[model samples]
Target: MTRKIGTEEAIKRWNRFADAYAANHTELGDIHKEVFLNPAIFSLIDTVKNKRVLDAGCGEGYFSRLLAKAGAAVTAVDYSPRMIDIAKERTPDDLPIEYRHGNCEDLNMLEDKSFDLIISNMVMQDLADYEKAFQEMHRLLTDRGCFIFSILHPCFITPESGWEKSKDGKKLHWNVDQYFYEGTYEQKLGERENMLFFHRTLTSYMNTLMKTGFMLEGIIEPKPSEEMLKKYPSFEEDFRCPDFIVFKLKKR
Candidate 1:
C-alpha cells in the first residue's frame, strides 16, 4: 500500500491492474459507486444532461460512460495511452464519448470554454501539478461551468495503515507512521513514472482551491454500508475516521 505513484511504475502497474481496476474499484472497491456519480456532485443542477463534459484523468472511462449514458457530450482524458485505448474499447457504440490521450496538467489540446462540467474522479491525488490542472479546468469550463472532483482524503486517511489477512489467520494492524516522510515513492516494480500522492494538509487543499479560482459548492464523505460493517468488523473505525471525500466546485 506504501508504493510510489509515477508514470514509470504506474504505467505498468496500472496496465497490469487495469483489467482488475476496471472490473472493481481501486479505492472503494465498487461499494461506493456514487462517489463518481452522486446526485449532489454531478446532478446537483442542470449541468450534466446534454452538457459538454470533460472527465480529466479518467481511468478506463467508467464515469465517462455513465455521463454519456445520461445524455452528455463527454470527452474523457487520461495521462496514460493504454488507459485511453481501454477506455475507447469499453464505451458503448452510441455513447458519444470521446476518449483522448492527454495529461491532466496540460490540457492545451482542448480549446477554451469547451466543456460545461469538468470532472476529475479520485485522480487529484495522482497528480503533481494540480494547480496547473485547476487552471486548465478553469480555462476549459464555460463562463459559469463547474469542476467536480474526488480524491483520497489526506488529513485522516493514510495508505499504509490498512489491514490485510495474514497466513496465520490473525488480524494484524500495521503501524506505518510514514506521514512525516512526504516524498515520492516507487512501487515494487522497477518502473517509477507514476505520481505518488503528496498529501498536503486540509488547509493547504482549501487554500489551493481558493487560489485557483474555484468555489467549493458541496462535499460528500461516503461511509461504509451496514452490510460492510457486518461483513468487515474493522470498518466501523470510520466512525472516528472517514475514508473517502467527494467535492463539488465551480469557477469563481
Candidate 2:
C-alpha cells in the first residue's frame, strides 16, 4: 500500500511537474479539458459578464482566461507557485485576471462573500482536504452565488479502476475496485511524475458537500458532442463509461 501524503507534498509534486503539465494546456486547455470539461462547465455557469468570479484552482489559467474574455473580473488561484507563474505568463496584460498562489483547503487571504461565482474545474479530487476547500468556497461566495466543480467520478474513478484489456490488448469493460477507500494515492501523470489524488465515494462527496453548506443544483456526466467526436474519433469509447463528473452547487 502506498503511504498517504498531505496537501503540501501534493503541491510540491505539482510544482515539479508544472512545466510539463502546462505544456499540454493551450488556450482551451488540454484535449480532455476541451472535449469533456469546458462544455459542461460553461453550460452550468450563468453569464460571467461583469461578475466577480473566482477560478479557485485555476491551473494554467485557461479557464480563467475564458472567464475574463467573457467579461468576468476573475481572480485565479493555484496551490503551486510555479503554476501561478505559468498562469501569469500565459495571461495577457489586458485580460481581467489576477493570478494568486493559494491552496484551496484554506484561502484566508480572500475575503468572505466576495465572489459572485466560483469555479474549480477538474480540481476537487486533487486536493487532500476537499471538505475544507468546499467550506472555503462557500465562505467566498455571495449569498446568491454558485460554485461549479469537476472531478473524476467518485463512483467510477476509484484508486483501483481502469479498463480491463483483452488477451490481444483490446480494451474491454472498465474495472472498478476499492470504492470506499479514502486517502492519497499516486497516479502517473508524466514519464517521471506521479501525481497524488484523493479518492472518495459518491456518498461521501455528497454528504461532505451538504455538510459544507452547499445546495446541490445540478450534476452532469459529460459526453462528447458531435463536434468533439468529429475532432477526436477515439472519444467514441468514452460513451461506454463516464470518466468525469461536473457539479453545480448553490450557497444556501
lDDT of 1 by residue, 76-95 (tens): 99877777887887767888
Write candidate 2's Cα lDDT for 58-159 as tens digits: 888999999999999999999999999999999999998989999999999999999999999988888888889999999999996999999999889888
Model 2 misplacement above 4 A? 1-3
RMSD of model 2 against the true structure:
0.9
Model 2's TM-score against the true structure? 0.98
Candidate 1, RMSD to the unseen true structure: 4.6
Query: How accurate locally, in lDDT, is each candidate?
Result: 0.69, 0.92
Error of 2 at 44 (Å): 0.6
Q: Against the true structure, what is each candidate's TM-score?
A: 0.77, 0.98
Error of 2 at 217 (Å): 0.8
Off by over 4 Å in 1: 1-13, 25-29, 32-47, 163-182, 185-195, 225-237
